[model samples]
Target: MPTSNEAVKLQHDAGAAPTAAEAVRAIDGIAPTTGTARQVADGVWWIRLPVAAGPGHVNVYALQDRDGIVLVDTGTNAPQTLQALTEALCILEPNHGTIRRVVVTHHHPDHIGLAGWFAERGAEIVATRGTLAVAHRMLHDKTLSRTPEEIDFAVLAGMKDLELAAFIRRPKRRYADGVAMLPNATSVIADGETLQIGKRCWTAIVGNGHAVDHLTLCSNDGLAITGDQILPGMSTNLNVPADQPDLDPISAWRDTCRRIGEHIDERSVCLPGHHTPFTGIAIRSRQMAASQEAVVSRLLEHLQRPRTAIDCLAAIYRRTLSLAERAFLFPEAVGYMNHLANRGEIVGLRRGKTMVWQKQRRPRGDTIRREASPAISRPYNFSSEVDESR
Candidate 1:
């Protein structure tokens, strides 16, 4: 895609109507249709898989390697998604090489679902320790019952007894169901660690908020396999965990966006988890931060009177939510409320079992201070297998 930098250069080069490619690149970037592969960068291909759930599609990257191809962020293990992925891989097989390493961006099923499938085909699984820990746990556990902590959180989010029960009784989509096989071993990568894939050396950068220890790798030339961290035209979900009610994901997300933005410039073409490949990393980072600030402002207005996270949902989203949607989005509402509470823009009080948030009045000339990023140590030792397992 032509970045803001490229557009500037284009103006000085010639004065003519833009080509179809240039025009699309100048606009909203390029979105590769599902079941297809497009070369976003030299030796780097963007493969999009069709998803029946959220976003309608998920993007995976295939980086050319010395021995084979290094696949980043596998799509879901659903039959159609797998078929689409297989077809895309086959189309690139003649030039790109075989699968050498499957690098998972996070533990989300849509992103990591096909890791086991690739691993079975002699591809080494690679991901952050935190991601591996959660992936392994979910892949091994088959139960669908809600935990005591989850029930408590449902109540805190204003979920009624009947509603909570119905949510629990609904059919579950387990993590194991998304993977073709169990991930027996993984090569863990740390933040700032450099990995050699083909002629490129990518530095692993950790991103939070969307997922615990989300892995993002930026090459020396500025091409980034960003996963879900820095998507174009959409805000990454910042969900608060039930166990960690006080965790401030917004601060972490904002810091992560800034941190990732520092590595790339306006010319870097980032391969994201969803949507399309685009440039202007720093600009996109600022946009994401601004988007969150706008959400916070709207939320503060919604808190004119005391309101529960559930009560403010309509005001914040302005849409009717299904039971499934509520189950998926309730934690994010808590996250926004917690972010406001942490900023001192709002105060939360316990009303029996539920928590109601009220806007806080600050003195004249007083400014709200930004919260420091949460310090959560990653589970580095979660992997019993070593990197040499490959």
Candidate 2:
């Protein structure tokens, strides 16, 4: 793959193609797919597949197993994605294009949508029990993610009546819209289960938040397959669903951050779901925790006066919001607001028919907690057993 960085380096320095060494240092910095697989490690290859709609491609990894290739994640389903998948498979696993097994990290549309695509072709699908359960329900009922409860929640967050009416009339986004088809069956993977892929033994370190029971694979040989758990460039969406009003995703996400820093070595390379894979995970994990906490603190200060979750959107993101962005933005804003309420920093009271968050005390604006030890520990002791449990 010709990295955008590689081209710029060519003009600045001598003509030097992207090297495995450079890719090892900063995988995300490496140019995306040049219509072929880029070797990130000895037996691991990186493949970038186009999304139906997004800024760039979704990075999928293919590991060499004894019998055939073991895929970490599948890009979203569609003819366009299938075309990209076939082209990459032709280059990486040309022997018989044999994908012996497909391991999914979570139940996100992009990661789980194409599980059936490979399963239909005989690859055994692997994912958490919760993920499979949700997939089945989504296949049965398409409009589950966005219901009247969501509209009501949005109104509680302060979305105007006109926007709410327009949104309900055009509730086009649904769970099934992202997932092409559900695999009839999946060989479920539990937390702390070791999987032998290629020459390494990878263990499934399941953590809560960011899609409950999200599995991040930590290999014995200092390699971690972090599916959206530990992305390089951006933060994962930690939102609370309208139905599960009690779930604290930020706290759950913090526990996952601790697990990554504790289980995975600092020097180990993390092959993430999006962006480039990178090393130095210990530092990155702490940075992520601090950044998230700062976002929470910022919101709490904004809540000194009563504010709806919708009103808090501007406090977090100062720019204009898009319809697609609001789908995520509202939930995450509510999640942070809920975290504050849970911490006794804010109070959520019924303002007329909807809910609004107000500060419990004078806002402790931007007071970074100082301690002898680390900032994050075991996180809040709540687990999203799944939507059913919620």
Best by TM-score: 1
Q: Please give, for residues 103-129, the per-residue lDDT of candidate 1 as tens digits.
A: 989988889888898888888999999
Query: What TM-score would you give candidate 1 relative to the actual structure?
Result: 0.85
Local distance difference test values of all predictions, in order: 0.73, 0.69
Cα displacement (angstroms), candidate 2, residue 243, comes to: 1.5
TM-score of each: 0.85, 0.83
lDDT of 2 by residue, 276-373 (tens): 77886755554455556556656767887888888887676655566656655677787777666656667778877678888776444432221211
Candidate 1, position 71, lDDT: 91
Angstrom error of the Cα, residue 307, model 2: value is 0.7
Model 1 misplacement above 4 A: 1-35, 364-390
Show pairs that collide, candidate 1. 227-273
